[model samples]
Target: MNLEEKLKQLPNDAGVYQYFDKDGHLLYIGKAKVLKNRVKSYFKFTPKLLPADKLSPRIYKMITEVESLEWIVVPNEHDALILENSLIKQLKPKYNILLRDDKTYPYIYINLNEDFPRLEITRKVLKEKNIKYFGPYSIGARDMLDSIYEIVPLVQKKSCIKGKEACLFHQINKCHAPCEGKITKEDYAKLVDEALGFIYNKNKLVTKLNSKMEEYSADFRFEEAMKLRDRIKSIKKSQIQTGMDLATNENLDLFAIKAINNKAVLVRMFFRDGKLASSNHNYIKQNKDDINIDINEAYSRAIVNYYDNELPLLPSEILIADEIEEKRDIEEFIKQKFSKSISILNPKRGKKKEIIQVAHNNCDELLRLQNTSSETSLYEDLKLLFNLEKTPNRFECFDNSHMMGQATVGAMVTWEEKFVKSDFRHYNLEAKDEYAQMRETLMRRVESFEKNPAPDMWVIDGGETLLKLARDIRDSCGVNLDIVAIAKEKLDFKAHRAKGSAKDIIFYERAGEILKLELLPSDKRLQFIQRLRDEAHRFAITFHKKQKRKEDTQISLLQIKGIGEAKVKKLLLYFGTFDNIKNANLKELKEILNEKDAMLLLNYFKNLEG
Candidate 1:
């Protein structure tokens, strides 16, 4: 629709709005409390009250080029704030501030789906069902893990169920030997809960440690008492300090922002027990037209995103360096998600204000250093653009090839940053159906995980049907690998005719929800995936042809003079039935096959296509 028509129909509620250029390229994305009022303000202003010169030159250019407008209405401003962030990342509009980070901290994760769960260290935390993740402790993540292991007596090896005998760890009391039935699952579960409680609540941890120290003294074990005493003191001293005057028992998250030369930097200082526990900073690349945007809008957008998608952790209080546009909206969202009360404040005085300044100062140094590395940034872009958990450094592309349900074969090509020919493999299939071929192929490929584990991701050369098979294989094998599917826009299978060119359909996922992306031919990601898929196709087709060549000898018709295996097979197929060819007279067969071939084929009971 035209701009005027779209504007007249704009909703009067909070929502995210988009401005598109004549070419249908997204120019800008924004969140507004009242979509109608906010959108109208852009073009409705007269030169007298609101001077045209007051607007940023970049905005003026964007406004005139805007041929169409679209909006998605949400329940409240917080929903608009969230929708806007997701769209900005997905579309990467020309006129918006892009805030992202290349580095992610390590977190201790527990996968509760296993019969005996395993605790592992991971830098990436995904929102999957039945999995718990803790800590982004920057400097001492290893030490934190070690501390928990010592207190919990959990499994220290890859598989506790495998080591039937009490290993060294169990002998030294580092593990409770669940495999040997020395500890019940119920008892072991309590120890795991206690370790998790210590990580989440410090007061309870200190109290429990203190009680242990007293018990050791009453038992007359002075050496153990001294050790327990030192542990208690160390726990108390490990408390973080933020140089703030507020009470040290409450938890808070302090946010600060700074913008310069149209680029912006945001800093978030996490406070637990009213002390700085961890901090994060990200620089935002702003579009030229973004000069007209206010810092308050940025803060509002940042607040919604940081709490909702970026971190799983939460605090009772959230302090901002400046007032944001929709404080009530943000508070409401936080309350609903956490199911508890939350206070969002803009401090005017006291220590809360001082911490804001400290965060702001950190942004200045960040801008000076410009420490964003290029290699890491590329992977971040790939992850966001492709919707992946890890940077796909190694990926495999799979494809199946067949000719008339004969000589069916499946091929998988490995790519480590680029093609790795030595790691490529082909599977001979027994299934005649195409979809069945895919399932069997994937089952065999994943079975190899016993000897060689799966790649970072698998790129299948088909649609969601093939992707589902890949996912099933991964779950059954207990392998952790991401799946991507690439298919053609059209499927044409005319023999001896060139396959028409079509755009690739890329299937990606975010938090297990699959999304389809169609990029232009010139897009780099599309080209890269095409190369991987094409290699797999080439490998499969080449093997299928080789299989057909080998089978040609079994017919024994290829040894005949002036007659080939291909011509003989085609003549047999043209007939309604292959058995008719064996009984046909020379005169009857010459009409379909050549005279010399008719003599040769009449002598041989041709066994092939009907």
Candidate 2:
């Protein structure tokens, strides 16, 4: 059907509508209570189809390009909201504001199932029933865990208990020798409770650290004092000091969005027991010409996309900076999904308004800082240099690391304003040659495009051959992705690996021709590409070293007369590292394996040393 006829057939029931251009590319998606009114409001008949007079410049431009319309009728607005989010994520329409921040924050957790559990940090939700999780901290989780270990006498390491004997940690008094039954389980529980108090009360933890710092300084332990001082600063920095406590012990999640020049920043703050616990911010880059986009839609998508995850805790209420048009729909969706009654409020006055103002100010400051950063100019330079279709917001770089074709591995690192560590991936490749390894890595990545969509560009760490290989792999997968490769200057067909003195060349395909450009070492664009290539190299090498180490350990231990895979694994688990196992006496080995097997292992190690 034609666009006009399809518009006329729109149903009155709630549903999602999609706009497409002449080339059949999705332009936008929207959910509405009445598909007919909402879809018709974008255009006026007036004898001929035209954009409505009250439409924003952004939407007006979109309407001018929209050549077709489609709608899916749903049972109600709640389903419409859900379907809209799902389609936008899967399709990634042009006009939609996609939140690129998929990072999982760290949480300090304790598995209570163990008799003497050690505190550890995790980015994912564990499947343990008897567990307690602390904050989903944006920063300072490691520092906090370290400080707890420094202050309390708990199990110092995971392998400590399995050792079934005291180690250096117990001798140094960092642990209570729980492995040797020097400390009772009840006493260890007290230490665990003390550590929990530090996680629960940030202020108390800071105060205690300060006292310890003072004590250390007075005893001439300046180094120890300085370390404690740094930890205290880190823990304090994690807490958002809003300066305006609700004083009512109310819990809420505050969301504030600010946009300017097609750049939007969403600031989210979590308040628990009337105190600001943690906060996070995300940057949303809109279409190039979409400066005056709708803020209400941005707010709606942000709230829905964030809460879509299985959160560890849900606040009693949600506060937003603006009164979005789809507030009621979001609340209903949340109620249905979470089975919890919560209010989403946009306050006009009082403490709630003040809190929202704080978040808004944060968003504004973040946007301002982003505008002034060198990354903006760097992106513009890169786009012009490469003659790219648009400023590349997201980049995925690939590199291969191996030792004479042994322990081959490939790594892909992501960059969006910063190194997106969560999206970085490493692959163990069986392909021995460099070209084959690069091809395999790119192929595997392209195959998973449905789950993890392709980035705007691919940066490879090789010369023209590997670059073309990447392009061929991507094309074979029927995906149109930009690719560039950086390689070190070659001397007599050998790559110069020296840093600072070696020059680098960048190659990109333009108009079906391979173009090689050699920029000065001082060029910011060159430095940017170098950073990405180096990170990919570092990641791949790290993984390769780990694989190589594991292989070496397996081969060496399996050669021992009474040791097999199971016994080797037990020894490694107890000692944590191969070096530790080598230094371990017969007693430590016996703790993990049979006495005879332990003797055999000890003799093998001793003979090697001799």
Candidate 3:
């Protein structure tokens, strides 16, 4: 239907409304209590009645591109709010305040369903029964995890039980080895609870680290003491600072935003059971295609998007830095998303106001640090793009190179903050088919956990099929590794009917499905993934060429039955060459070889050496 005809049919019920451009690209997603009244407001305005300045530049521009309108009728505004947020994340429309991030905050998870639950780190906060999750720490998540492992004698590796016998880790007391029945499930449950206690009471872990540092110093182990001191510093740096407590055991979240030079930063602080647990900060920027956003509007957009799209702890009270226009509307959203009452308040005075002020101060300092640097950290962009659990410190890229089925090889290049040529790995493959080659390559790579720990992320050169094989290898070997695949650039440029040209694309898991990056050639994401694919291809091709060169000159002596390198060496040493060995009789061959070897070799070369 056309714009006017569709607008005439708007229902009185609440719902999410979407505006689309002539070309069908989404312009905006919005929620309304009364669909007819809100949707009709746009047509009611005229250039003379509402001047350009009175209508926000953003709204004005959005209206210009809006050639058609569509909406869903819902029972209440709360449902509309959630639907709108989901649509925004799913479509990523041009006019929405896209909540781009530098990193995905990490949360400490302990699955209570398992008999012996161990603490682990993750980025996704899923809603599941018996899966208890702790802080979404902004920094030092690894340090915190390492600190917890020091005091907790729990399962350390994902694939801990390799065989019937206890491994060295159990012998060294690092693991209780529940796989081998060293500790009862009940006893391990107690240790898990102790570890959870440490998570709540982080001070205990800090104290233990301090004591270890002092012991090392007293023993004149300065190197060990220094390492301990660094760990302590990381814990302190990443921990949430104290603020004016509400003096109640209520769970709540306080948000404070600071806007400068048309840019904004929103700081979210968590308070559970009257304790300040942790806080996270993110910057808000206007898309180049969209109009600039005001600080007040940005605050509203963040509140709706944060809770509706990114599922966080449902707080009883949500305090804001300033009065927002959609305060009651947001409260309705929280009520529906989480079946509980929420107070979206702008406190004027007292302890609650002080909490808001603290959050504001945090943004001020964070903005300063952000501006001092020329750009955000490289790892930060990757974390947000791929939705990884942490700033990926260790990046390993895999590529398989071969001409047909001969001289097959697999290459892995490592990058830790920076590329490390010294750590590059090359593998010779035995499989003839592509899928088998990938499976065998990955199986051999992750089979040895003690030799090489799992990296934060693995980039493979192929599509979803190859990436799935990598995941299977990880699961069978019991490792927590993140695997993503980059599709090679299409030889035909017309494949880019939408993105302008053929470019290498990255495939990563988001909201359960594998998502292909909608990237352009000039985009930083395209450049970053292209570099990894190129490096892997270069290493694999180099290794394949070397293997082919060696194979070209050598005879297929290794293929002979019952004749290995030692037997071949003895024959050559006695007869001078392979030709000479082929001219020898069984009596002459038996002089240098054992009976079994001589008979097998003589039978194979009967016509030449009989």
- On TM-score, the candidate that comes out on top is 2
How does residue 42 of candidate 2 score in lDDT?
94
Count of backbone collisions within predicted model 2: 0
For candidate 2, the lDDT comes to 0.84
Model 1, which residues run further than 4 Å from truth?
A: 9-14, 45-61, 73-79, 101-143, 146-165, 171-246, 287-293, 310-312, 371-610
lDDT of 3 by residue, 206-241 (tens): 898899788989999999889878888887876457
Candidate rank order under lDDT: 2, 3, 1
Of candidates 2 and 1, the better by TM-score: 2
User: Considering TM-score, which of the candidate structures 2 and 3 is the better prediction for this target?
Assistant: 2
Per-residue C-alpha lDDT of model 1 across residues 334-401, encoded as one tens digit per residue: 77766777889988887877877777778777766654544335445666687653455567889999
Which 10 consecutive positions of candidate 1 have the poorest summed lDDT? 45-54
Off by over 4 Å in 2: 1-26, 31-40, 45-49, 67-80, 111-118, 125-130, 159-167, 177-193, 211-230, 420-423, 433-436, 443-456, 463-482, 488-503, 509-515, 557-610
- Residues 1-610 of candidate 2 have per-residue lDDT tens digits of 8899999899989999999888776788998899999999999999999999999888888899999988899998889998888777656677777765534567778999999899998876677798876666777889889988988888988989988789999888899987788989998899999998888678888888899899999999999999999898888878667887798877788889988878889888888777777788888766455666578988888888877766666788999998888787899989998899789999999999998888888888898898898888888788889987557788999998899877899899999888988789989899999888988898888766644656778999999998888877865654435789999889989988677678899999887788999998889899999999999999998999998986676587877767887877877788898888888888877788788887888788788768
For residue 109, model 1's alpha carbon misses the true position, in angstroms, by 7.9
Off by over 4 Å in 3: 1-11, 22-24, 43-53, 101-106, 109-133, 152-198, 201-204, 210-234, 243-246, 288-297, 309-313, 376-610
